[model samples]
Target: MSDARQYFDLPSPFAMKRGGSLQGARIAYETWGSLNAAQDNAVLILTGLSPSAHAASNAEDPSHGWWEGMLGPGKAIDTRRWFVICVNSLGSDKGSTCPASLDPATGETYRLNFPDLSLEDVANAAQALVKSLGIEQLACLIGCSMGGMSALGYMVLHPGGVRTHISVDTAPQAQPFAIAIRSLQREAIRLDPSWHGGQYGDQSYPDIGMSIARKLGVITYRSAMEWNGRFARIRLDPEQREEQPFGFEFQVESYLESHARRFVRTFDPNSYLYLSRASDWFDMAEYGNGNVMEGLQRIRVEQALVIGVSTDILFPLEQQEQIAEGLQAAGAKVEFVALDSPQGHDAFLVDIENYSRAIGGFLARI
Candidate 1:
């Protein structure tokens, strides 16, 4: 509400959690509503892997964002009551400094040369932005998926920066199954001849492999029940299948194709590789000598909320339970909410009303 989307320039030679640092790094972000006189009503919203800083409809941009259904004036986030700040994660293709961005040293895109990124880097960059805004504490810090992992990192890195923490449909670390799936997805891209070991400049992108990878990803993001309910035994016309070499008999296959096509046009293959690997590289327990509860002990929030979808095999309800239990064991107030839905790992994205109601109720208490 204060202004449209904006950029925050991080201090030069940006340091990373890993070894190297980046030069001229900047983060793109958007804000909604006004910061109360106390600056205590600001809410930090972190997105999953592919979303931009545009979390919801705002004055400058009215288009719907990935979380459009749950944000805005009277929505779950309720911009009318709280100032919302959504920062595009570093290494994202969307407006943030990334592999696609030019290296200030060489005047060319970093591409594969970009330093390895980690969830800590994302959390640090966001915290820098918050400090730049002169905000002392956040009313709540909320995230979904990869964002949730970042939220965990933020809680540990800056223990007193946020008062409430909300993590939705994400695990504290990438589970083995999730990592294996993403490994194959990365393999798909590298196996593409056009990918040229991530230097595919001027040549055709690895669209074929990217598409295949996305198709596989779709399966993991959704539940069997949802697929069955939506595309039960439906088949495409034989003639249409013949016309399109990649066409499939099942409507579910077509759904995957549509999403893949839409994604490749906007997402950069190298950035995808980086972000996916970053997720796998994140492990919350590393903060406290491989003990999750020990790591959680570093968190200084008044309240914590963990939400998990029953059908989410990727993140799983058990993962959320782990987070809540760890917080409680560490002497923090915690609430664990289990949502039943057919949407699987993506329930937070698709089952809007359920998530909205749960999150809204939590925010009200905050």
Candidate 2:
């Protein structure tokens, strides 16, 4: 765990909005391909909330990697062609600095003490990492969801850093519905008896809180159509799926339970809280005080592509259109496409053909 956390760029200055400056805030990341003699082969791909620095092949899980479908030799983000870099954002807990990491001041974990991180701060830290690699400009900046927000913020914040931007099912600001759902998920964690205000004692973990939080999150990450189609009131023999196992009569209950359990095992509760809060506080309008057009005008990228899914409840197709509209208004050559997929917001990750076609065409044009 310590070694994993060590793969970082620490003490990266960020004058936060919540108050005092964070001293040990770090960004965990990894790079793929090579930066050519001119360092112009650089392609920056920011990660969503859960993914890590392992974007392409590595010694472990070497059979391609995450985003493998889109990023390959002759594919869209071809690693055989361009240099790729992916980083774990500062507030992320997946081996990056977050509430789980120990605070240098007290030697105790930051836990709830980890300051609130905004999308702009994430973009700034990621920009610092990009600069460290000697990349003064990027061929492209592509991201999904929260990562998508960061990508747009990067384009807006730096103006001339990236030539092309690809945003997938993302928006400039988190919608109210998104915020409400995320806030409820965080509340689920806090309401747990064992949570103890983000501090579960050294003994027992906040199992109940974390489990509930994951369930809440899973409910939003997917679509109702998917749930109905997958579960369909069908039970596992005897007309009861969650029964004899201390019982759940509804198929939805069983499905949610399994997802919640899996998430509890794979994710840290504090990390969930931190990232959720960070997302809840996201707003593109804040950057421009009030004018979204002004915010959009700040970007200087040559071209842009925004992809959205029709059934996505988290970030609907309309939100994605708004992103494209914002870019087009900025005088950027923008294209908006709403991919037809029933998988909801996660369609960007699951529906490969449509995503690949859009991304490939867009990149090919560039």
Candidate 3:
């Protein structure tokens, strides 16, 4: 029961919070399984930065999805028992309202003209879509990384509306280091002569710029230990060095380069910009004036599951601990599952056994 839609209509101006004409930008999404008679079986799944609306099994490509490995009939998400919905972020490139979307005024891509968007705005758009679909309450709101930030926004703005929330590998507020990383990624895109301040789609989007940003992200997403084990001691001897046909490279470097190339091919530069900015600017307390505990204290969800990776410096265990402690103080039932894996922040994506067990257990409890 997998189905997808490329767009939906909303009879109103689609302007971003920072202010710009989104014109007629559309949102892409997919639904899994059937809604129960009460229509309360819907579970919203928000994707990390870089992923489109695609989330589960669909006829367009039945065998592929960003989260195909973890979501299915018998898997952790269990489409058999829940109606799952994944939507593209408003400023995202994947058929969503974004800079790349056509601007009615200019009849061209919004490009850099798209205004900045807050995490709250993205959440509001999702909420609007949900309402349009006639869903008043979500069984669960699950998100990872940037998506986690959006989930935080939802919890903050619409208390008691979501029954459960699963925040994976991120926090409500961006760390300084995270901000710096996003700044650099944004700069990388800007440096490309073709980027033209994110309007770079004439002779093809800024592939180089996007590739560079993705490479930087990969460095943070994966753990050093995992890299060491995967490509340790493998170096480019002179004979193997292919300066031209034979490139000069270490196996690890080769792996990273290949990964970067694929990422650029699949990703859109503007979407990257929008999502990254959304992630960096996401401090739930920013609107509430930097009071995180105050914000968390408002959440009335019965339960929450916080997932952390031991080696994830990006979203370190300390940050997750803070969240757990705050939630406990709020008298909410919350559990933290720290997975031991060398994959760092991305352990949630690669380390299957521990993740499967943890998720299955949680879903079972529900």
Candidate 4:
């Protein structure tokens, strides 16, 4: 693992949040710029559900990550000024040790046998990586969607480690509405005949179920206004599917299919199950013994910024507002920015300029 600068092995026998420990546990991460002599210029970026450690173009990999529009030398979270590090989540299929990883004890993929995981585990793993890098304090920790939850978890878990926290399009806890959607996504994957209790082996996978789930996710990630504006009633040519109902004619169906196909090809089905469930299981209030403010109060960060998009129904402006209020109530300096955009929950990734402005300005102050 040391041979590959992209991967880091946590000093082995890493303990998980639920129980049990992983031997030879490894984390995949990408770094930009240089860590200063004091190691105080580090910025940790936690990704959403599907992004990899490749958060932007760098020397090793020129390809841009999902947040290409916002991260780079001169962009928001500028690598020119801060040593930015992005780590793939612990349970992610992208290069990280996940359900798809080999089980050293049995010489088989962990699959369903992978231990129960949670957002706390995700935060802890990233923290471990930071410590291993010899970073005593972070200039900032940034997250969006699931990453946002991880950022909050970092604050609660290690109160003084991060100097600032930036959360976008996320909440302290997964709302029931969001949980219901994710539960359905998991159900779709489990119901696929090929899943075979997550023991499909080398045979075909649950592509149908995984594809369906991704489609469902696309619907939630994008706003109805944006879909209508982009797709409208546009129909696939009648020659494409003569026997199909007119309802399937919308271009949106084609869009969903294309995106889902891309996702199902690379993502591991079991990893999806674990990570999605982990997101729902995260609840700061529970950590606070039923009071969110209590959990927020535990965070000792110098300041925080929360950004919300108006069209994000999955995690709406109200949720971000509450996060800011909780932080304020906890006596932590906080700033909440509500943005109006058509991208819904995905605005942070797609509508880059808005996020760049808010983030860049905030980082400047920090």
Candidate 3, residues 116-223: lDDT per residue as tens digits?
A: 877776777787777788788898888887788788788778876788878788886888988898889888887888777765655756777877888889999998
lDDT of 1 by residue, 300-356 (tens): 788888999999988989989988988787777898999998999999999999999
Candidate 4's C-alpha runs over 4 A off are 1-5, 239-247
- The estimated TM-scores of all candidates read 0.97, 0.91, 0.93, 0.96
- In model 1, state the lDDT of residue 60: 84
Clashes by residue pair, model 3: 242-246, 242-247, 242-248, 243-246
lDDT of 2 at 355: 94
Model 1: pairs clashing at backbone N, Cα or C within 3 Å: 1-33
Among these predictions, the greatest TM-score belongs to: 1
Candidate 3 matches the true fold with a TM-score of 0.93
lDDT of each residue in 1-366, candidate 2, tens digit only:
111222656444556655545676777776656678887778888877777766666444466556778776677777666777788876777666777888888999888887776767778878877887788999889888889988877887787899888898877787789988888878887887778877776566777777777777677778888777888777656555544766777777877788778766566678778777777776777667676656666778888988999888888888788788888887889989987787888787778889999988888788
lDDT digits (tens) for residues 181-263 of candidate 4: 99999999999999999987557789899999999999999899998889988988876543756545668887888899899
Candidate 4 or 3, higher TM-score: 4
Best-to-worst ranking by lDDT: 1, 4, 3, 2
Q: What is the total number of backbone clashes in candidate 4?
A: 0
Predictions: Cα RMSD each: 1.3, 3.0, 2.3, 1.9
The local distance difference test score of each candidate is: 0.88, 0.76, 0.77, 0.87
